[model samples]
Target: MVEVNQFYLKFEANPDRYTLSDLNFCLNHGESLLLLGPSGCGKSTLTYCLNGLYPRELDGEMRGEIVINGKPATEYRPGEISQQVGVVFQDPETQFCMLTVEDEVAFGLENIGVPHEIMEGKINHVLEMVQLLAFKKSAISSLSGGQKQRLALACILALEPSLLILDEPTANLDPIAKKDVIHTIQSIQEKTNCSLIIIEHQLDGWTELTERCLLLNRKGIIFYDGDIRDAIAFKLDELQEQGIWLPKITQYLLKKRLKTEQKLPLTVKEFEEKPFSLFGNEEVNEGNNLPEAGLPYIKASHISWKVGQQPIIQDISLTLYNGEFIAIVGANGSGKTSFSRILAGIQRPTKGSVSIKDRKLGSWKESQLREEVGYVFQNPEHQFIANTVFDEIAFSLRLKMENEAVVKEKVQAVLETCGLLQLQHEHPYALSQGQKRRLSVAAMIVDDQPFLLLDEPTFGQDASSNAELMGLLQGRYESGATIAMITHDMELIHDFATRVIVLHKGRLVADLAPTELWQLPIEKLHKWQLALPIQVQVQNCLKKEGDYAAQSS
Candidate 1:
C-alpha cells in the first residue's frame, strides 16, 4: 500500500537542514503501523510526504522515492494521491468546509466525484460507523472536540481511501472521548481492511491495535522497526531515551521491577493475569501532603459566564491560594477553559465577582493585571506576537524597559530551559506544534508572574518536552507562584497537581486532593470521563488482591 526508499525532506526556510533524513519503510495492505517519535522529530513531516502534501502543497524539497498504491508520488496528478491516501490531521477544525456533519461528509464525497444518488447513503454509512449518525444535522461548531474528530474521520472514510493516516487523532480529546475515537478507528479498520499509519505520542490505547512499530530518533532517522512487542520488551530503554511514551502497564513494570521472565504486558487486563505483588511491606500513601493554605491569590465567587443564551460557566466558586498547584479537569466543552479565563481576568463573568489579592478583577489596570497574572492560551499561536523565538520570549522583558544585557540573559535562560535555544533565530510560526507550545510557555514564564494560568500547556508535547515544561512550572510553584492549568491528562494531575478541580455541565462539582479525586466511585469517574492514573490503578489492583487473599486464609 505504501513504500518509501531513502527519503529526505528539506524546507526552503532551512535549506541546509533536513527535516527528515533517510527514512525507509513500507506498509502492506491491511497492516497498521504505529509511528513513534519525540517532539519535532519529523513524524508529522513524514505523514505529509506520504499524503502528497510535501513538495506539491508545502514549500519543501523531497529526494528519493515515495510510492503509494503502486504509483510514484511525483507521477500522480494534483490532489490525485488523496483519493488513495487520506489524512486526518491533528486539528480536525482545519479539515472541515461545511457547517453540518452531513454536509461536511458530503463535501468530501462531492470532491471525490461520488454519484449524487449514493452521496447521502455514503455519508450516513460513514457517520454511522463513527457513531455520529444522530448528529448528522448538527452544526460543526456545536460538536465537542471528540465529536469533531469523529466527524473528521467520517469525512475521510467516506472517500474510501485505501490508506488512512491519523495524526494524533486523540491528542486533544478527553479520556472517554479518546477511547471512543480509538474504538471508532478500530471498528473502521476491521470493516474496511484499510492500511493505517498513526502518528501519536499517547500510546496506551493504540498499542493494542497496531502490530508493527516504527521508532524515530531525534535526528529524524529510523531507530527501530519491527514487531511492537519486540520493541517494547527488548528496546524499552532506547525507546524511553528517545522520549517515546510506553504503554501504561509497561511503565508500571519498569517502575516496580517485578521479578518475571514473561513478556511485558501492554494493557491492564494482561497485567492482571500475571502473579505479581505490587505492595508487600510498605503501606500505600495515596494522599499527598499539600502545602499549608497561604494568602488567597485569586478568589472567584458565584462566577457565571455565558455566550448569548448558552451558559458556559455556572455559579462556580473557588479560591487559589499562594503557591498552589491546581489542575482543572473535565470533559471537553465542560467549561474548563471558560473558568480558567475568568480567573486569569481574560474573560469577564456574566455574574458574580473575581478578586486577586483583595482587589476586584475589574478594578486592576491593564498594565497592573499583566504584571500580576500570566495567561497561556490552549492554542499557542493565539498568544504569539513576536517574529523570532528569542524575540517572543524577550518581548515581555523588553516591555518593562529592562537592560539589553539583562533581557538577553533572562531570555536565553528560558529558551534553554524550554529546549528552544537552538531554534532562537527561527520564526515562531515556523516551529513545530510542540515547539510552538513550548515557546508560548517559555515566553510567559521568563517574567515570573505571581499567578500563572495555563490552558492545556502540554497538549502537543512529547515525553521529554513535557517533563521539561512541567519541571520549569514546578520550580515556579516552589518559588511562591500560584499555578492553575486546564488539562485532559490524568497523569499530569496525579504527578504535579496538589488540588484537582472537577467541572460538569459548566458547574463546579468536586474539588479535592488528587488522591481523593482518585477514590471517587468508579461509575462517577466514568460519568465525568475521568481515568485513574496508572500508578493509582496498580495500587488499587494490589489492594483488591490482598483483601481477597486475607479473606481466603
Candidate 2:
C-alpha cells in the first residue's frame, strides 16, 4: 500500500535540519505498522509525506520519494491520495469540514464520486465499525472528545482507502472510547484487508493489533523496524526510562528487570503466559490504606445545559473534594464538554445549580468566578488571544491590573513553571502544538485559580510534553488547587487521577476511585469507547504477579 525510498525532509526555515532523513521503508497490503516518536520529531511530517501533504499543503522542502500503491506521493493530487490513504488527524476538530456527523462522513464519499446508494451503505458500515451507528444524525458540536474522534475514524473508513493512517486517535479518550476506536479500526482492517499505519503515543492499543513497529528518534529517522513484539522488548528499557509509551505489560516486566532472554511482554496474553512468568502475580503489592476524603471543593447538583434547540448535558450531579485530581471521561456525545463548561461557569447549567464552597453559581460574580475557576479549552489555538507568548501569558495578569512589578514577577514565574520562558517573545502560532498547550496553561495558571478545568490537555502532546504538563498540574493540585480534567488518556487516569467520572449517552454512569473503576465487570465504560490504563491494567498486574519475587522486585 505504501513505499518510501531514502525518504527525508527538511523544514524550509532550516535546510541543514532534516525532519525525516534517509528513511527507506514500505507497508505491504493488509499490514499494520506503528510510527513512534517524540513531539515535533516529524512523525506527523512523515505522515503528510505519505499523501503529498508535505510539498503541497505544508510547503516544506522534500527529498527522495514516497510512493503510494505503485506511484510517487508527489505526483498524486491530495484528492487522488485520499482514495488510497485516509488519515484521521490528531485534532478531530481540524479534520472536520462539516457541521454534523452524518454530513461529515458522507462528505468524503461525495468527493470520491461514490453513488448515493453505495455511500449510504458505506457510511453505515463505517459507523457500525466505529460503534457510532446510532449517532448518524448527531451534530458535530454535540459529540464528546471521544465521540468526535470516533466520527473522524468513520469518515476515513467510509472512503474505503487502501491504507489508513491515524495520528494519536486515542490521545484524550477514556478507556471505553479508546477500545471502541481500536475495535472499529481492527474490524475494518480485518474485513477490508487494508493496510493500517498508526502514529500514536498510547502504545497499548496497537500492541496486539499491529504487524510491525517503526521507532523514530529526534532526527525523524527510522531506527527500528521489525516485528512489533521484538521492537518493544529490544527497546523496552530505553523507552521506559524516557517515559515513552510502550505496551503496558512490557513496561511492567521491564520495571521489575526480569531475568529473561525474551524481550518485555508486548501484550496482555504474553505477559500472562510467558518465559517471564517465574514471578507471576507480582504487580499488586500488600494492602495499603486508601486515602480519606472530605466535602468536595466544587459541587454541581443535577446540572443540565443546552445549546440552541438541542440539549447537550442532561441533569448531572457530581462532587470534587479538595486536592483530588478528577477525570471526567465519556464518548464524543457523552457531554464531557458540557459538564466542563458548567463546572467552569463558562456555560450556566440550565436546570441545576453549581457551587464552590457552598456558594451558589448565581451568588458568585462573573469576575469572581473567573478568578476561582480556570478553564482550558480543547482547541489551544482558540485560547491564544494575544500576539506574543509573553503578552498571552500576561493577559490574565493584566486583567487584575496589579503593580507593574508584581505582574512581571507573576508572569515570569508561570513562564518558568510552564517551561516557556525562553520563548516568551515568540509568536504563539510559531510554537509547536505542545508549546501552544503550555502557553494556554500559562495563561490560566499565572492567575492562580483554585479550580482548574482542562479539556483534553494532552491530545497532540508527546510523552515529554505530557509529563511536563502533568507535573505542572500536579504542583497546583498539591498546593490545594482542585483539578478536573477531561481526557481519553487511560494512562493519565491511572498515573494521576484520584477519581474518575464516566458519562454515557449524556448521563453520568460511573463516579468512582481509579482503582475501583478498573475492577468493574460490566462494559459500560467500553460502551462509551475507552480502555484500561497501561499501568493498572489487568494484564500488567497479571504479568507482575506471574514473576518470582526477585524478578518482580
Candidate 3:
C-alpha cells in the first residue's frame, strides 16, 4: 500500500547534510513495521515523508518517489493525504487544535468534510476504543500527558485512516499509561486491521505488535530489515552499538550466555512458557549509598497549590538536605512536576511557605534566587532562549557582564563536558533529542547552583547518553549540590536515587530508600502508576514459581 523508491532528503540550510539517503521500503496493507534507531537517525523524518509533510509542509530537498495507496504522493490534495495517513507526534500538545476532547476529535472530521450527523458517532467510537469516552468533555488544558496522547490518537483514528504512524507516543507517559496506550493500539489493530508504523525507543512495548523491523544507521541508511525475531536474535549487538534499545529479556539472556534454538521471546509470558529453570538468577542493582547530607538546603512548610479551585498539590511539608540525590515519582497529574516547580520558586504555593538555607524564599532577590536554585524544565524547549547552543549555556554568564575570555572558557568547558562541543555552532532546536537533553543540563549546571531541580532529565535519551548525563549529575551532587528529579524510569530510580518520594493525587504518600520503595505491595505501586524494574519483575515471578534462589538481592 505504501512504497518509497531511492528516496533521499536533505534540508535547505545544509544541502550536503542528508537526513535520509537511498532509503527504500514497502508496507503492504495491514502490516505493522517497527522502526528503530538512535536519536536523530531520521526515524521521524521517514514518517514525515510518508505522511506528505516533507518537501510540502517543511523546507527540504527530495530526490525520489513516494507512493501511497498505489497513487503518487504529489497527486493527493494538500489536506486529503492526511485522511489516508494519520500521524501522532511525539508531543501530543503540538497536535491539539480544539479545547475539549470531543471537539479535538471532531475537528479533524469536520475539516475532512465528514457530515456532522456522523461525526459524533465516529468520535464516540474512537474515544471508546481508547477508553477515554468518560473524558470526552474534559478540557484539553486539564488533561494529563497520557490522556492528551490518547486524545491525539482518538483524533487521528476518528478519521478512519488506512495507515497510522505514531512517533514515540508513550515517551512522556507514566508506566501504567504506557501499558494502556500499547494495549489500546493492539486492540485497534485487531479490530480494524489497519497498517501501522511506529518509531519508538522502548522495544518491549512494541514487541507484540511488531511483525517486521527496520533498522537505520547514523546516516539514515537502512542497515537491516527483516522479521522481528531475526532482527532481535541476529542484529542485537549492532543495533545496541548504534544506540537502539533492546528488550530487557534479550539483554538478560545474552548476559547469561544462554542459547535458545526456539524463537526468541518478546513477552514475559513467552519467556515463562519455557521451563522456569532455564533462566538464571540475576541480582537487582541496589542504588548508590545515601550521602551524609548536612543541614536542610530546602524546607517546604505546609505547601499547597491549586488552579481555579482544583488542588494540584496538597499541604505537603518536607525537608531536602544538601547533597542528597532524590527522585520524585507518581502518576500523571499527581503533582510531581508541580511540587518540583514550587521548590524552584517557579510556582507559588497557594498556602504555606518555603525557605532555602534558613532564609525565607520571598526574602531573597530574584537574581540571587535564580542563581541559588536552578531548574530544568520537563520540555527542554520550554527553557531554551538562545539561538545557538554556545550562546545558550553562556547566557547566564553574559548577564553578569563577564569578560569575553572568561565566558568563552566557561562555555567551552561545559560544551565539552556535555559532548556537545561539535554542535557548538548549531542551532539549539536542530539538535537531537538526546543532545538537547544534555544541553539543557549543561546550561543549568554552568552556574554551579547549590540546588538543582530537573524534571524527566532522561526523557528521549539512549542508554549511553543517559549514563553520561547521570555521571555529570553525580559529580555535581558530590560537590554538595542537592538534586531533585521527577522521573518514571524505575531502572533509574533503582540504580541512582538515594531516596524515592512517592506522591498520589496531590498528596505525599511515601518517603523511603530505594529498597524500601521496592518492597511496597505491587498493588500499592500500581495505584500510583508506578512499577517495579524489569529485573525485579522477573525475579518476583521466578520466586512465585518455586525458585527462591532467583530472588533479586
lDDT of each: 0.86, 0.78, 0.84
Candidate No. with top TM-score: 1
Task: Name the lDDT value of residue 516 in candidate 3.
Answer: 82
* Cα lDDT of model 2 by residue, 459-526, tens digit: 76666667788999999988988888998777678778888888876788888787777767647557
Off by over 4 Å in 2: 13-16, 236-243, 275-277, 280-296, 307-311, 402-426, 430-435, 522-553
Error of 2 at 32 (Å): 1.9
Error of 1 at 307 (Å): 2.3
Better of 1 and 3 by lDDT: 1
Error of 3 at 478 (Å): 2.9
Worst 10 residues of 1 by lDDT: 276-285
Error of 2 at 189 (Å): 2.5
Clashes of 1: 0
Please estimate how well model 1 matches the true structure, expressed as its whole-model Cα lDDT: 0.86
Q: Which prediction has more favorable TM-score, 2 or 3?
A: 3
For candidate 3, write residues 217-304 as lDDT tens digits: 8888999988878876787788778877777666656656777677666777677767766664455454555666578889999999
Clashing pairs in 3: none
Name the better of 1 and 2 by TM-score: 1
